[model samples]
Target: AAWKAFLNVSQSIIAIAFGAWAYESLGGTHGTPLESNLVAFFGLAVAFFTTNMISVSIFFVIRNKNTFLSVLRQVVGPGGINIVYGLLASPIALIAAFLYDKLYVGGILLIILPIFLIRYSYLSKIQLQQSNQDLLKVLVKTIETRDPYTSGHSLRVSRLARFIALELGLSARRVEMIETAALLHDIGKIDSVYAEIIRKRDRLTDEEHRVIKTHAVKGAELLQSLTSLPEEVIKGVRHHHERYDGKGYPDGLAGKEIPISARIIMLCDSIDAMLSDRPYRAALSVDQVAEEIQRCAGSQFDPDIVAVVLRGETLEKAAAQIREASLPDVVGV
Candidate 1:
């Protein structure tokens, strides 16, 4: 944290210095035309914004031990609203300068309140996003905690889904949504009503099976009521159980009728389940999983997705990742 703080202060200082230089170099202090002043102010804002983005991106790359491009994608990618807010806030300094020139001390004082308010609001937004993410982690943990047999299940599925999405040449935004959906795909199992059904060792009765099928819809409803998540994510959770041939689940969605995210997640979910050991069956080999998928294609699973899984080391890669990340079951925890 202290290192991060130092980096933050350093980046701000560097950005401010660059902005000041650009402003002065553009004849900001002299009797300049209105057009020139506008140019100078925007130049200053751009200088500050660019420098700050670079410095912060570098810090994130180093701190997270991730690649620079990954950091860039997060800042400029699909859900980078915070970065947009920062860009919008960059112009506020120019506004402050303009006010100061017009009304001197009074103008400066007048702008101070708004400046603080904007800063406060931005901070609050950051805090809220952080809190929401923390809450999501807790929920994922709780979901796994409820059913001991599936410890670390959601996380593995999420990773596998991300890999599959990337392999399928999906956009980064779509991949992110798919990963999130996979992580929360089984959230319905966390419902109080699912407690006994989830923990039951024996095979489910016809009634129990029917009740279990409602989980996909229930999970979607839970996300809708509790989160401001995207509609795609909700639909992904809702339709994950639908069969490609229209024979499965609460929605029997067939082929292209199913959302792509749901399609990808449904396959990934099955892959994880097939690979994991359950009371009724031991974990299957990667080859066996591939064979099962191949056999079920066009009926239970999306044939196109099944093809992707069977293609050139794709299933191997996904299975290797899950195996590498295997954790102890949370049976008693």
Candidate 2:
């Protein structure tokens, strides 16, 4: 986000610098040279800032296909409104200065700059969040490259997990974190023996299953020191395979002992796995898949989450959502 923001600002930076340079070099047509130059500098700043804000806000709205009103929260709420207001108000300042050469109009905006600075702090927070999300995406994609069969597995799991999270009434922030964790949940397999066996044509032996189980713990340990992710997210990644009845691997947390995020993710993960083809078996039918989830309730899966997921979407519709939202753009992982 920062790099992209910088790219957005680069043209404005040039425009401002070049405007100032030209103002001094070409000399002013009206008012004193110093006065005209200052007006040009401020005018360009307001113009550039407002234009950049509008473009970025529009990009996000189109990219996410969110409601048009969402722009108020995403853009205007984060000081974008101030930028636009200033840009629109700049005309008054410019006109006043045009009629009578004085620093008062520009000075009014100078006073508003401190408020802009405060609003910009909020913008910075959003950018930092976007940057972390982007970095995780890059990491997830890199891991996918290592295990080609799981090409869209992580992404599909993430979208499904996000759906489950929302269904469970988790806060949006929590849902986003869980989604991020889901995308990188299988990252530990990048260097593990399971990477080779993950898509094998034959069933796994006892030892291979055990090795595959180690991935959850390995993934948590891999992320423990990152410090950027929320603790709940890491915990969910670690315990996503844990059963509701305590027979699951790793910590084997049972019932409420399992983190809610983990429980939600577990169901999402299992559903995607069942819907997709495996080396050992073909994908399960929607009815079969629903029955399987029902059969495993309170044992391998959380009964409450299972009930919620089974309420509306069938296995086929869920699979469709995953394909539309999470599939990789190209053939390879």
Per-residue CA lDDT of candidate 2, range 1-333, in tens? 897778667756755565455545554355454454665546565545545555655766576544444443444434355566666665654555554444566866665677689889999999999998778778778777754546677878888787666555555567788888888787777665666666655777898888889989888988898887889989988998889999897997999999887887788788888877766677777889899999999888888888877875645666786456455568765
Work out the TM-score per prediction.
0.65, 0.63
List ranges where model 2 is wrong by over 4 Å.
Answer: 1-111, 314-316, 322-333
Candidate 1, 18-38: lDDT as tens digits: 988998887676665445587
In model 1, where do residues sit more than 4 Å from their true spots? 9-35, 54-71, 78-87, 103-105, 122-146, 155-183, 190-193, 203-207, 222-230, 243-248, 254-257, 271-275, 281-333
Best by TM-score: 1
Best by lDDT: 1
Q: What is the lDDT, from 0 to 100, of the residue 209 in candidate 2?
A: 84
Report lDDT (Cα) of residue 267, candidate 1.
89
Q: On a 0 to 1 TM-score scale, where does candidate 1 land against the true structure?
A: 0.65
Q: Over the full model, what C-alpha lDDT does candidate 2 score relative to the true structure?
A: 0.72
